[model samples]
Target: MSDAVPLLPFVRRDRAMRWAVGIGAGWLAAFVVLLVIAQIHPSTAIVDLPYLVPIVVAVGLSFAAAWKTSGRTRIAWVLFAVSNLLWLIGEVIWVFYTYVFQRGPPAVSVADFFYLSSYVLAVPAILVAIGSSGHLRHIRGLLDAGLLALGVGTIGWQVAIAPSLPHAPRLADAVAFAYPLFGVATVTLLAAVGLAGRHRLPAWAGLVGAGFAVAGVTDAVYAYTIAKQNIDSNWINIGWQVEAVLLGLGAVAAIRRPEPETRQRDRVRDLTAVPLVIAAMSAAGLILADRLDGGPITGGTLAILLALFAGVLARQLLIIRDRTRLATQLRAALREQERLAITDGLTGVYNRRFFQEMLRIEAERADRADSPLSVILLDLDEFKKVNDGYGHPAGDTVLAQIADRIRGSVRAADIVARYGGEEFGCLLPGVDEEVAIEIAEQIRQSIGRLEVAVGQGRSVKLTSSLGVATAGTRGGHSLDDPDGLVNEADSALYRAKATGRNRVVAAGMLVDPVYADPDLPIGLVWLADRIDAQISVHEHSTAVSRWSLLVAERLGLDMAALRRVGAAGRLHDIGKVMVADSVLRKALPLTAREWEDLRRHPDESARLLTELGGRPDLAAVAAAHHEWFDGTGYPRGLAGAQIPIEARVIAVTDAWAAMLADRPFAPTLTVDEARVEIERGRGTQFDPAVADAFLALVTAGMIGALAEPARA
Candidate 1:
């Protein structure tokens, strides 16, 4: 595949392909240019034929590199590499024999063909330093420049000198102009391309293209000397030798140098017009000084002043615009931050701080203008007990619905805030006692009729208690008082709560302060007991959850992240409330139908927790608890880790728990017996890691809670 393994330290398949493509493209381009060189030197058969063997090596390497790396990438690109190598071969034959043995002095012979043809191998050596990307990056532009420059040079030189002699070779006629013009155009183009890009490869390629720089200079000197018929012209070979050195320099620079990072920065700087600015300034200054055209002294001075002023103004304008844009951006950001500060994220209501601030504004306004303003106080009944019973998620839903209903009933100008817990406050602008009471009643009734759903088909019928108070001007003096009004409204609210919630009461000029009673941790000890109870749950739940986790861990998932799987796994069977205890504890064989119905624990567990304010992510895991790694084991036959990791862990743990716990249908097994059962199930039903961990736990005396103590 490699033709031979590259012994060069830098050799690889990539370098091989790059060299092949570059040589193929370069030579093919050279041939097209050589056609122009041929025309200019029709009689000079050799025309020095500078580029040949490089073509054949390209073709040869294309085949070799393609074979070497074909298996790693697409076969077609590899084949393309082979084609490049073959093209190199064609360039070799044309360079030496046909032209060298023909005539035109320099003592050339056809015998030098093989000796010259061997020079193509130097390319692969270059590939040792620079890789494939360098070749492909440069070759196209190099070929194009060579063709265009050679074509132009041929035409220019032939036209300039061909008219002098009828039988003279075009090379003698065209060499003076042909060599220099073509050389300059090609080298300059390569330099331009190299300087334009950011990638090191392009710049390197450009520099390599400029490698022909010295060759062009030598040809120019030689043509001039030969045409002059100078006898000692051969002594000028010393200067011409410099051209060969430049060629080698270009090749070495292209091969040894890495891709340039400056290419991109240079282009961006160009686009920025920094140079253009300098050029414009220089031209303006020169013109003002009367360098290009005649001008009155007075007018020249004015123009110079105007030009300097304009440049300074433009620079200042750009700086000012950038600063202004930054300031506007910062202002907008602050406005958004302020807006978020006042709004409740969950229910989109005015929060406590904003509501209080707005109330102060409206109350002061009402007092000054001799206008009426009323305030309403409200609280949802049994809010805390509902949270404790159904879970906090359900409590949040109840609060959200209460806010929605109150919002619908209040005036557009009214301000509302969550006072605390289930309590809320509303400030009514331009409304008196009667209107406030009506609004408060409407809100109370609306909330009373509302139904917010929890898990399963269960829904909560929400109700709230409301209190209303109003203040207005009396005898041209504003009779408004914020603290007094709030207190009266609160007293009325307490009255409603006292008389079985879901009703509203008017303050009716009463202004006694109302103190809210404290509600403590309420059931802290009960919660503690609940937490302690879970230790037993963990033991039984571990039978399936741990096993499922082990299987999932050994199967593929990271063992560390298995906490989600483990937590879900541990709680997998919490839904047994729906399964009859009779069925769970039955000793005899279950009918096929009973077994079918018993597998519904995961679904029931998920539903149960959802009602209990469980996290949605945890609920989802519990729902799929019975699922197994293999599609064969489940209510839904999912295979190959298709089951949730949590479900798999829980499934294994559930099995372990059932085996160890006393059972009517089967004798309870000790930890060791349970471990054996799991090991027998590896790959079939249990995960290997799960079985091993369980056995290890038993063996390491970690089975204190797992095994019953023998009686003395």
Candidate 2:
């Protein structure tokens, strides 16, 4: 795994190298000039401090080398690469000048030869490093070739350093030239190759190579002058130093100029040797211990060095071990956070959000596996009543029980979720419609039988309506169509609840009786069931009232009963909703609909229950409830029980519920008015028996607890 960079000390070691090299070059230039001047005036070599020349030049070279070396580059690579390029040019020129140009001695010291040839192996190794920058990952062959060449050159240099038999002067010249020649040849060849592969190195590296070659020729001329005793060589010495420095700087610039490989390798330090912090501490302790030891701290300080080294080693181990453990723990934490984001809390089911995510996944799986999947959705029936009556805590308990039942009923492979407040969903993988239906039915029954215990020593019986939708992976498939599973299951669930309650229904096309003789296909059966259920549901709303004629249709109360019931139920002091219990329970009567409306009950109820659609049966019977059989009604008039059965029945019941009601209607109507109203309404208003039946049902306490006030 890759890591982000840590903040670290930013010392420009690269700039340091340039300073050291520049300083060293200045001093070296003066030395070369001194030597040239001394050649012109031989006596000066003896009279002056000629020896001081080496010292000054060496100091400058060391400073320049150290400073230049202080950069962000690898010390080994610089030694191996850049230094070699400089040495190659310098040695070839110097050798050619001293031995080849003026018919001078061809012999060369082994020490000199060994020193210059070493760079040949060095340059390519670093170049190899600079080239293998993962960006060129496809060029393994080129990288391998560079590495191989570097190895061969290094081994050859080592072999040359071995005691080859001493040679004659001329042979030595040829051999000496041979080492620099080999280096020159390799660099030249690689330059050609790299040029051909210009795509690899930029144009500048090639130009750098060419410039170095030209400078090499100039150095050769300067070397020839240094060898000759008869030259006014100030120009040659100055020219060589200037040329060499330029060439050296040029090579370095090319190397530093952001090659992909150089960056890749340079970025990560070789902290493998020791933890950086411990290395710092070790370096610190060494300096302190050295200073304490005073006079040229020596081998006798061995014990101190050993102890410091041990501490350094221990710190490194601690750093490595701790870092490893920290990385592992971090990864584990990341994984856990990922898990929680995709999970649901309450049902431990996936939740709708995750279901959607999984559905996409399963849709793909279905295509790949060539299988089927179905979604089953379920919602609790009369869930609001449970919340309103038993309380929300009970509602929650019911939902939990439902979720558990769903889990138990679905196949283990299926995924289930608490779809929403009162609704749950399941995804059945590799299961078709038939199996899905069976599973749905099972879940439906499971919920129905569940008993949820809420607080207050009470338990609620539960039932759920279910919808099932299915789809196959056969077509040019996609799951983005949100309705596929959703619409069907929703339609199915609607059907289940619509045909009264506690029933299952399917979504299928309706077939006319003429074309339908056979039992429906399973799907058709479900569809038909859903259709029938949907049509059969009765509309009911708060527009319903005790004496509303609609109540007569319910109880099978007759026509005259319907008319009186309608009259009483429709106007049963619709006034009360607006009236205070204090005003309503007063011993009084209203002269008109005006009096009842002031209380706002009738008007408010009418507004609140605006459309009569939901309460078709009740609204119709209630519309003309005040119309007397004698055509004495305010809103509308119809005489002699020319009213509906529901109206008549509601009239009787309304009078009864009111007589028993604590309202501002004649001191809660004594048993006498209750009976007087009952007898008085016979024929003219009530269907005598209907009125009599209401009296009996009312007296028998069938209208139980009417006189009791349950409202706070």
Candidate 3:
């Protein structure tokens, strides 16, 4: 009833309600006039016409309400129309008996059947209207409705039904008793709905409830009068006319535009509870009265009580179940939200935030236990090419696959995370430098083997560069700071990219620039300056110096010879500073004249080192780095042993670095391709002995060790 209030300006609502009241008053006045005329004339024609006219008008108004309302309200309106139509049919039959047959209708006749059926339709119509109004979802509301109905029905039965039941025939008595009981049930249910709703009850709903109440009281009076043989009364007809007019007014009120209802929870303090308690007390009193009369409780009475109890219990159980289900669903929703917060949306791996927290925790634990903790930072080589050439979708596919492989490759104790775009981080607790490097190498090789399908029939091979850094090593960077440890690993990663792709570089092998001696020989210091000028170069001179020492030692060179070889390797590309930046940064292949100008770098390096008072042996070796073993190379074309062994070693290491390192002029080559190139030039461009020593070091896995920073 509360849900049916029209949402309009206050002034408008007041005017509308006043208009409705006026119409209702006018209709009542007309009824009074017809009733007076009937009493004066006492003609069947006058009685039938006045009685039928108001009822027909009520039915028409109900149909109009049904047509105007929408959604669930329309259904309620239609049911109201049906009930009014049924009432009209009952009245027409009564008129027929009076005018055509010239006799009164029987008490339990077809007219009574139609009248009873109207109650049947009207009761559900009111209930549906309340239910569809969104006020009955609470368990308290249902309980309130049931309790009120039980109490009201009991009171009505005692007052109206018991007294007249013994005087009438069994069938007629049953029909008369059922009418008031049905009316009580309908009125109680409607009142409960009104009380349970948070908003004010609608005027139309109240009028409808009033109509039902009037009709129920009228039925009770008519029955009692009939049983007492005093039923031919104008007052009974007046009651019927009032009920019809009330129903008609209710139907007209239904067309008012409904207000937007403010929803609230029903409280226990509502006055509806008082009536329920009083009705219960009344029913108990009746039972006591029956006991005092020595009337044993019948099976029907017991059955009714048990049925009511079962209904209350069922409603309670359903409420409990619904609450439990809602709690479980809420818990699951929270867990899913937490998971989404920590996981990468594209790859489903731990994202940067989670990884950072985990790394900090692991670092603290490792520092406390004096255990090794390592981090491996990996970046996909040429990832931008995948995005540019194959499209972002293909790039995404490659990223997901790479993350999957990293997860599968690492041990369960290790944490793998997507650190950022094209970069991944792994935290390995209780892993040392050697083991971390081994794991990183495995990741590098595995990524190299990946052939991701971009689209069409085309596939692209992918590769990665990894850097390994361990904490808790003597004389190494501190592990107590997680950010410092990560920076160390990132530095090693930068070196890996600088020296070559598709390989792993260890933090222990990274050069400490702060510790570099300022008083170094002029040539080496000058070489460092030249290397710093290049944008694409990354610690290449340092890598070459380290590789040269490794190769010279492997070939059994003496300490003095090794020193010269290492110096020459470090200064090998120092003359590149003298070359034009345009030629150095060119993307296309160099022209023949540009190549000729490039060929003079070796001689220029020798001249600069010699003038700077560097070792003559180192300078001579740098000058002949391009001299071939077959005498088909460089400025002098010196072949075989004719080329200095130091120069030959530098040439092999320099070529390897150039092949592995990224350059604007050419794509980087894999380690296997570099090895093949080195092998192919063994006799023609490389000293056989130096080349053999280098390949032996590779076979023995010493090259990977040399790729790391020199341990203190």
Q: Rank the candidates by lDDT, best first.
A: 3, 1, 2
Candidate 1 deviation (Cα RMSD): 25.7
Per-residue C-alpha lDDT of model 3 across residues 1-712, encoded as one tens digit per residue:
3444442333256776567667777877877776688788876565566777767878998899889877666777799899989989988998888878888787578998888888788876876665424333444445555555565655555665555556535777667666766666666666666665544545666677788888877776776675566755665776777788788777777776543233345566665444446455655756775687798976655655565566556645654676576689899999989989988989988898998999889988988998889999999887898888878999899899999889887898888999989999999998888678768877776676677777898887776878888888776557778888899899888877764455677776632121222223655555554663472544466556667776887788876776677666767777776788788878998999899888898988887777764546667888999998899999888888778888889888888877777778878888889899999999888888889999876665545421321111
Per residue, candidate 1 scores C-alpha lDDT tens digits across 1-712 of 1121222323233464356345545654555565565666653332234443343333343344334332222132233333233323333333434455553333233322332232223222222212222433334233333333443343433343333344646433443444465454444434434432233343223333333455455555655554555524233333323333233223333233222322232244432223224334544544444543475545534553455445444544543564576599899989878878987766678787887777778888987887888889998877776787778998888788789898998978788878877889999988877567668867866776677886777787766778887877342113455767778788889976763355566675211111111121213213322422433322354334324443454456663445556455545566665666667667788888778767876677677556663445667777765655555665666655666655655555667776776656778787668778877776667545554655554454322232221111
- The clash numbers for all candidates, in the given order, read 39, 37, 11
For model 2, the superposed segments whose C-alpha errors exceed 4 Å read: 1-329, 364-370, 389-394, 473-482, 509-712
Report the error of model 1 at residue 710, Å.
53
Which scores greater on lDDT, model 2 or model 3? Answer: 3
Q: Please tell me which model should have the higher TM-score, number 1 or number 2.
A: 1
Ranking by TM-score: 3, 1, 2
Error of 2 at 484 (Å): 2.4
RMSD of 2: 20.4
Candidate 3 regions off by >4 Å?
1-11, 14-18, 36-70, 78-99, 111-128, 132-147, 167-169, 191-287, 329-712
Best by lDDT: 3
